[model samples]
Target: MQDQPLNAADFDAIESTLLKYGDDHSVLNPSELDGYFTALVSSPEQVDIAEWFPGIWGGQNPAWETPDEAKQFIELSVRHINTLARQLAEDSAAFAPRFEQTEHLGHDVTLAEEWCFGYLRGVAVANWTPLPAIQATLLQAISDCAEQDNFELPQDLDVVAHQQRVAAIAPAVRALHDYWLSQR
Candidate 1:
């Protein structure tokens, strides 16, 4: 439950297990999965995890070889995700949201694009609404990310520039969280 309790090996283990169990049917990739949990717990309103867990499961039939494995997976995932949410909202300078596994966003836009989708899903399912202008603008930026597949980028912003834009999403998420919590 500590910040970044899962090292690379731990992450690999979890991801591989989930994938083996058909969790990839989930639209939220790993980074967005992190964002989803973070958004839920960061919300000003109380969120019932029990109610939301099924939605997070995303209708993926359990493919774990053993039922116990499925149970343990859910328990571990929930614990880690709750820890992530708390750490992100605390805004410790040492901690950043784990939107991607590597230091860089990626050579392509897909990770951020998936991340935006996941984050937006969290916001939507949590029913966080009527966002203030700044947060709304940030959501708009994320929306642009969501459109990465269909929308054409200007020729000037090459892959490097696109990656930089994706990397910039970390701060935008922080700002959105700050904006929402300020109402308290």
Candidate 2:
């Protein structure tokens, strides 16, 4: 397993591959993929790759042009999964969701909607259920961000509120990881 962390170039390659083969499917981008993998790793119950891999391409596997292309995708994804698992286990603070950077009201802001949505997707795939009240609340923080549609902020949500929810996601995820770790 190529456990070296994926650099920018690797992410670009993954993004390019998704765009090239995604067609009309709702394929996850690099940032979304990271969150998805994080949730899968943090899941209390182990999820098999055979079950979750298809979810990346929106319930179907992409048809790569060559065997090597498929191989590279699998390698990168497995490496990322392992990296997240290791980070969450060794140093939960080191685990950060890959959020997209953008400008909001003339200030630089990081948006986590896509990443949060991907995480929720993983949770659904893992069939996570019956959580204790505290852990449920932690997961709800990520859910708050996930509920927003792309580029469509809720009318009732001011910038401050939105930023607060986004800020809470990382800590909530870390706590969730810790909760599951303690269970094991």
TM-score, one value per model? 0.75, 0.92
lDDT of 1 at 120: 69
> Residue 78 in model 2: shift from native, Å?
0.8
| Model 2 weakest 10-residue run by lDDT | 149-158
Task: Judging by lDDT against the true structure, name the best candidate.
Answer: 2
What are the lDDT scores of the predictions, listed in order? 0.63, 0.83
Residue-level error in angstroms, candidate 1, position 156: 8.0
Candidate 2 lDDT tens digits, 44-142: 888999988888888888777899999998888888898999999998888889999876656566789889888988888888877999899999888
| Quality of model 1 by C-alpha lDDT | 0.63
Task: Spell out the clash pairs found in candidate 1.
Answer: none
Candidate 1 per-residue C-alpha lDDT over 40-77 given as tens digits, one digit per residue, 9 for 90 to 100:
76566756766556556674345458887777667666
